[model samples]
Target chain A: MAALSPGNQGVRLAVRYLVLILIALIFIFPLLFMLMNSLKPTEQLLADTSSLRAFLPVGDLSLDNYVDAFKRAPVGTFVFNSVLVTGVTVIASLFICSLAAFSFVFLDWVGRGILLSIILATLIIPFETIAIPLLLIVSKLPWFGLNGLEIGWLNTYRVQIIPWIADGLTIFLFVQYFKDLPSELVEAARVEGASWWQVYRRVIMPLSGPVLATGAILKFLVMYNQYLWPLIVVQEESYRPVMVGLGYFFQLNVAWGEVMAYLSLITLPVLAFYLALQRAFIASIASTGVKG
Target chain B: MARVSLKGVRKSFGTADVIKGVDIEIEDGEFVVFVGPSGCGKSTLLRMIAGLEDITDGTLEIGGRVVNDVAPKDRGIAMVFQTYAIFPHMTVRENVAFGLTIKGVPKAEKAEKVAAAARILQMEHLLDRRPSQLSGGQRQRVAIGRAIVRDPAVFLFDEPLSNLDAALRMDMRLEIGKLHQQLGATMIYVTHDQVEAMTLADKIVVLKDGKVMQAGSPMDLYHHPANLFVAGFLGAPSMNFISVDTRSVDNGLAMVANAALDPIEVATTGRDIRTGSRAILGVRPQYLVPSATPAEGMLHGKVTLTERLGAETVVEVGLNDGSRVIAAFGEDRILAPGTEIGLAFDPRQAHLFAEGDRP
Candidate 1:
């Protein structure tokens, strides 16, 4: 093999990095546009929409649109509701899905194969097909909470949190990861006198860092971006998640600045959550051969 | 130490029976090994004893108690797995102490037990290292240490040294032997390696297709294999079998003749022998000595191949009937291919099996 000269190698490296940077900028363009437009006034925001200047913080910038966005709707409550729902849903979803996957992968129960196939079959059926039936069921569900016997779960935090806790993809991810773990460890744990629960708690769960992160990130994204379900179910202001709350800024000629500000605000939690688990998520993806 | 016994144990997956009907009595403090080829049900039999596999149609007892329904942990046994099932996320100390911790042993006592196991395994300095950080042999020691900390009545090893390289496998083999001596625990080891079985087992159970072919001490199995399968499976170069025509018999001996070899007198051992009946003569490669010239009532063959090692040499001989027999000799002689050599076998050392015989 012939080796390239240092100058030639440097040029090749520069071109590769240039292509990567271009692709990264293409992906980040919308977020930059949102941030930049959120700082501008309404007139300037609309004026810069046609040009590259819209992505840059060039003309008039201030936090006035943020203040106006809060004044327009219960932005604080929407942000709170989305974060609460996503966080609780992520944690609960990870626990429930991973547990189910463990049982599906390890324990030899009757009909396990058919049940796993049924669950995997559900993955192809888009959630949109089941949305109305799921909504109808939750609408008439009864809850015996601090209020002692509520009739309906609609327009409540529990309605949002409960239905999204377990899904097919997250369980599949966990099952895929757990299947590769040596079965001997589980057998050894059993011989060590551990019950199946203890085996899962100590031996399996501790070694499941990457899959847990993968499951959590996926659940967070799914719950955070929930729009149709929350829009139809949650009529009260306090229960509306961020995606549904974005509609508040859409009325009466659409306060474009407030719209930009609300979008930028809602995108923060997703970015932060992803960044926190990006290392483990990437590790899980690499290990499990799963694409993002 | 514990005595484990299985009575007519059978295992089947659906319609396929893996272990037909196995009955074994393992004495206390005796190191027993189940050695067989793949798919021979040795591992399954061990798993049944460990209570990891349910007994399909029999009873299993450990330490005088029928433990067929007992959980693996409650059966008073700890198994070292072939994969060295050390937790990759935990330090060596934590992995070793896992069983005691799960049993809710007090923290101080757990520490003492873990420390003692680590010391015995020579893993004191490696207690803080994760499994990924340790070498293959060290990780296996940690696995053994895990089983030791439990202090169970019986220790089960499932091909625990098969994953290591050749040199490490020998080293680990010696270490496991020493560990068995030091602990004096009743250990049941399963391996496909006959050498491991020969070197470490106080009692060896040879299995073929879920049935115990023969169970005895190493020397007993080696010298007196009951059947053709056991004879072929026990040794490295393997025992050679030559078909002979029994022409006549006299005085408790059969006069056997094969083409290209002289007729010899083989002891019938009181078995029914008729004239013109086919029989097989069995002799180990180590017993087939190479002679300089043709001798009376001897087998002769042309040398087809020769392998020379430092300590010994193995030579393959082609008989006139298109079958080959291997002869192993000490490094005193090296014969080239195509060299004609006469092979002599002591009548007392040779084994003869009638057609369709089991023992």
Candidate 2:
């Protein structure tokens, strides 16, 4: 291929940038529409839906919809519950799944291959198939709380966090990444007088940032968007997550602006979590070919 | 700094028996090279001595203490892997200091030891760079630096230079030889390359099928190999074996007859050979030469292939009995393929193996 002339190169660059901007707009326009409509009144929001002004903050802008969204539901408690549940679940899942994967990959034990296959076989079974039985099992599970020896686990934070802590996909992702690491490094550390725990803490874990970020992002998204399980198990409004609390804005005369405002609020945590680990997430995807 | 001894050491996995009854004594401060073909249990034997592999039925002693139950880190030895095992996430300085740091060495002492090792490896300037930024040779040096900093009793290298290119392998080989000389440490090196074993080892151990074929100095093995395997394995363009029949001759010498050449008499040197019994004659390529004068025991063959290296020329000859023998000559000779030539070697340079004996 021959090199293009300077004038042709300029035109080519302009076309490339135009294509990229258009692609970016396709993904971002919905979020932009939500954010702009969140600042508008219901009337203006309904009217602006027909024009480009739906994505622009140009008409009757105010924080009244946000205030209304909070009044219509316990948005503060819902946000707090979602963050706490997602944070605890993600942190705990990373530790548990990575440890499980380490055993499956490095240590030689009898029946490991069969056990790994059985765990991976669970991935093909959809959660909807077992969700009802899971709910019934968790409803009667005993726990020691402030009052001591509670028989039922409904309307509790542990119910939301514990069930999502360990899963097949997260363990599989960690196993793939750990398998790619050179075994010689592990042996070298062993010969360097590091115990297995020291090797895991000092050597393996430091090299595992990409996989951990991948696992955490995936677990965060799954736990944050929890709706069906929480809707069945959590009857009280105080323990409802953001997705289940979204029903409050869908009354007989639906408040469109309040819906958008509540959506924009709930989306902030996911956006912040993803953007925080954006580089590592991309690195993990590029290395493992795993998509979240 | 330490002597390693193995007595009847064996390894078996599910009735396969990878290493069967190996026994050897390595003196203190001696560089020993375990030279063998692949799957010869050389690396497994080394791992058993390093305490990385368990000894199935025998005892392993290092510095006069039985250490069959000891861990690798407690065996007073360090290993450099075939793939340089320096941590990719750590700087060269940090990698060299890892063993000491994990042992809770003082900071000043750790820094001093790492610096000393870096200076010895000539990698002081690249101490701050991670392994990914370094070249293959530099990474290998960092691995050696890691081993040196521990100041272990014995150093183990598992085909450490096999990953490098030819020129770099030669340079690194010289560097390792120099390191051995300067440190005077007991080192066990393993490789499938005979050139490396012949060049670097004070004592060479040849293994095959999980058994020691021979063990001696490099020249001792080159001059007098115990069996056919050692004779063929120790040299490039390996020693040629020709089937011959032995007969009684004058002065108690054995007369050898073969289809490839005329009958020749050789001194048996107290070997048990009966008349009319079959034997094998072993001769190296360097000993065989293209001769013009008609002589006794001269073989006639056609030159099938010729490799003209600048310093010497090697030619493969095909005999009437469908056997091939390679002969090396000093002067450059342009011999075309299918050119008939007379090849001859001194009787004293020939080796005889009994027909029943195997490697």
Best by DockQ: 1
Instruction: List runs of model 1 lying over 4 Å from the truth.
Output: A290-292, B270-272
Residues B38-95, candidate 1: write the lDDT tens digits.
9999999999889888889988999999999998989999999898988888899999
lDDT for B329 in candidate 2 is 86
Model 2, runs deviating above 4 Å: A1-19, A50-52, A145-150, A289-292, B249-252, B269-272
lDDT of 2: 0.91
Model 1 Cα lDDT, one tens digit per residue, A56-136:
999889999999999999988999999999999889888899899999998989999999999888899987898999988
Give a tens-digit lDDT track for model 2, residues B1-359: 79999889889988999988888899999999999999999988888887777789888999898999999999999999999999988999989999998999999999999999988899999999999899999999999999999999999999999999999999999999999999999999999998899999999999998888899999999988888899889998899898888866456578997777878887765566668898888889898988889877788889999999978899999987788899988868889999999888898998877765566
Model 2 complex DockQ against the native: 0.78
RMSD of 2: 2.5
lDDT of 2 by residue, A1-292 (tens): 9889999999999999999999999999999999999999999988989999999989689999999999999999999999999999999999899999989988889999999999999999998999999998998999998898999889999999899899999999999989999998998998999988888888899999999999999899899999999999899888999999999998788999999999999999999999999999989878776432
Each candidate's interface RMSD: 0.7, 0.7
